[model samples]
Target: MKALYQYIKVIIQAFSSLLNGLLLTLKYFLTPGKSIITEQYPENRTTSIRIPERFAGELVLPHNENNEHKCTACTLCQLSCPNGSIEIFSKTIETEDGKKKKILDRWVYHLDMCTFCGQCVDACPSDAIQMKNNFELSAFDRNTLTRQLNRPDSRLEESNKQQKNTLAS
Candidate 1:
């Protein structure tokens, strides 16, 4: 009798689980307009479809109107990268006061090797880098995926220069 009771209990639990799943399916079927989970990418590509702000689509180093960036060549982002996707090359130059300081030369970003993990952005103390929502990253050639974040001849931002001057003094 105990064995039969145990078997019946198991069957009832299984049936309950099945019923719950079926109910969920029925609810979704009945409320198709409310249960939109997937976006029609091709059709909605040019539409006003909004990508969420938190989406880590592409890493970018933003520049100001003067073509200046805030990277101080601190190497914190490079050190924190788990996949070695970010390579920073800095050059030391003497400031007006003859103080030698390091500045960003080339910020090579290997998009092919990147896992879209925002660890590098979070590790940066200077807030030099951030992830942008422009996710059209498909490339025909692999070499095109490798990008340099800092533009040629770009220097540090004016505010950062002021901060450095204050710290130097």
Candidate 2:
């Protein structure tokens, strides 16, 4: 009789759980549009979605019309990066006064390995690097993921040039 009671109790609990699940399903089914959580991506890409200002997506170096940047090749951003995504290559150039100064040759950023922790941006003392709002970073080739942040013809700002000149003197 005890075994029969336990069996009956188990059957009742199973039926209770099933009824609870069915009630939840019915509640969602009867709701107007509240239960619909699927987002129509790509189709609604242009109109529906809005990217927030605080969203950190890709790293970019801003340059002015003069093709000047603030990066001094201090390597602080590269050092602070946990994933070693930033690689800076610098070249020493002899000034008119015969003073050798380090200049940024290439600022390689590996987007594939970047974790988007914003450490590089935070560590940049010159405020040369920053995260952009563009999140569409899909690529076909892995080599395409690696990009040079600095433009080929970009140079140091006039302020930095003056500072270097003063130091050299």
Candidate 3:
């Protein structure tokens, strides 16, 4: 009789679980529109979707109209990158006062290898790097993934230039 009772209890529990699952399905079926949490992706591409500010999309080096940037080529960002995504090439130049100093030549960023961990941005002491909101980073060739962060004609900021000049003098 105890074995029979146990069998009955197991049956009852199975039915209860089935009923709970059915009730959840019915709840969604009854109000399908209200229960939808997913967006129709490609169809809604024309519509603008809001992305949060904190979203880590892509790294960008902000440049002003004067073609100036704040990166001092300290290589902190490159050092902080775990995947070796950042490569900074600097050139030593002679100042107006005949003093030699290192200046940033190119800042190579490998987007394909980047994990979007934001370590490089956090490690940048000069606040030269930041994450931009642009998420559309598709490319046909992998070579396009590797980009130069600094503009070809960009130079250090005027304050940095002045400081370097002072140090040279």
Which candidate has the top score in lDDT?
1
Model 3 per-residue lDDT tens digits across residues 19-45: 999998888888888756677766785
Looking at model 1, residue 142 earns an lDDT score of 99
Candidate 1 Cα outliers beyond 4 Å, as residue runs: 1-19, 30-38, 46-48, 95-97, 165-169
Q: Please, what is the whole-model Cα lDDT of each candidate in the order they appear? A: 0.91, 0.90, 0.90
TM-score of each: 0.77, 0.79, 0.79
Please give the clash total of every predicted structure, in order.
0, 0, 0
Candidate 1 local lDDT, 61-125, one digit each (tens): 99998899998888989999999999999999997999788888899999999998899999987
- Residue-level lDDT of model 2, residues 25-109, one tens digit each, is 8887788597555668899888768899989999998898989998888789999999999999999999899978899999999
- State how far residue 105 of model 2 sits from its true place (Å): 0.4
The candidate 2 region of ten consecutive residues with least summed lDDT is 160-169
- The order by descending lDDT is 1, 2, 3
